[model samples]
Target: MDGQICCMVMRVNLDCNSCCRKMRRNILNMKEIEKHLIEKQQNRVSVCGRFKPADVAIKLRKKMNRRVEILEIEELPVHYEAEQEAPIVNHYKYY
Candidate 1:
């Protein structure tokens, strides 16, 4: 990957169960997202992947048609592991 692996947290208006479900579906459909967590109580969503934070925010805004506020963005450390005859693998720890 060219860009750094990172985790982005955003505050969104998740009002009901349907809203949460919609958000989950959207996040799951995004190919660039490796993992995601939706905190309905906090009205926040955390997404981890190799992507530009701004780009993700824009995408969410357009897809959700709701206000999206970026709360935090942090770069994650990449760990490499390899087995005896296997290719190297990249791993990321999501916080």
Candidate 2:
């Protein structure tokens, strides 16, 4: 492998948009992550994507009393392709 490491944005898809909002809020509430988010907003942050399938499945199993398995985590939003095609480059530049 090359010495340089590859990185991608971290994203977790929940069952619904409410879950996504809740998770985003939770992430924003974290002191450590808050700082990183600030940098991320500026597009100056470096990070790698992670998807803890086992952990998520365990949580679901405990809550729903049913088995769950996470297939993968997406770095960008599910609608990333459409967003990327947006003409609003200015908004991202400021972010």
Q: Write the per-residue lDDT of candidate 1 for residues 1-95, one digit (tens) a residue.
A: 43667889999999999999999988888888988999999999999888888888898899999999999998865552123237766797879
In the range 1-95, model 2's lDDT, one tens digit per residue, is 12222232333335555554554455454332212221323222222223333443354345434333333333444454456467853545543
Maximum-lDDT candidate: 1
Query: lDDT (0-100) at residue 31 of candidate 2?
Result: 35
Can you give the lDDT of residue 72 in candidate 1?
95
Question: Runs in model 2 with CA error above 4 Å?
Answer: 1-13, 35-95
* CA shift of 51, model 2, Å: 17
TM-scores for all candidates: the values are 0.78, 0.27
What TM-score does prediction 2 earn?
Answer: 0.27
Model 1 alpha-carbon drift over 4 Å, by segment: 80-95
Per-residue error for 89 in candidate 1, Å, reads 16
Clashing pairs in 2: 41-95
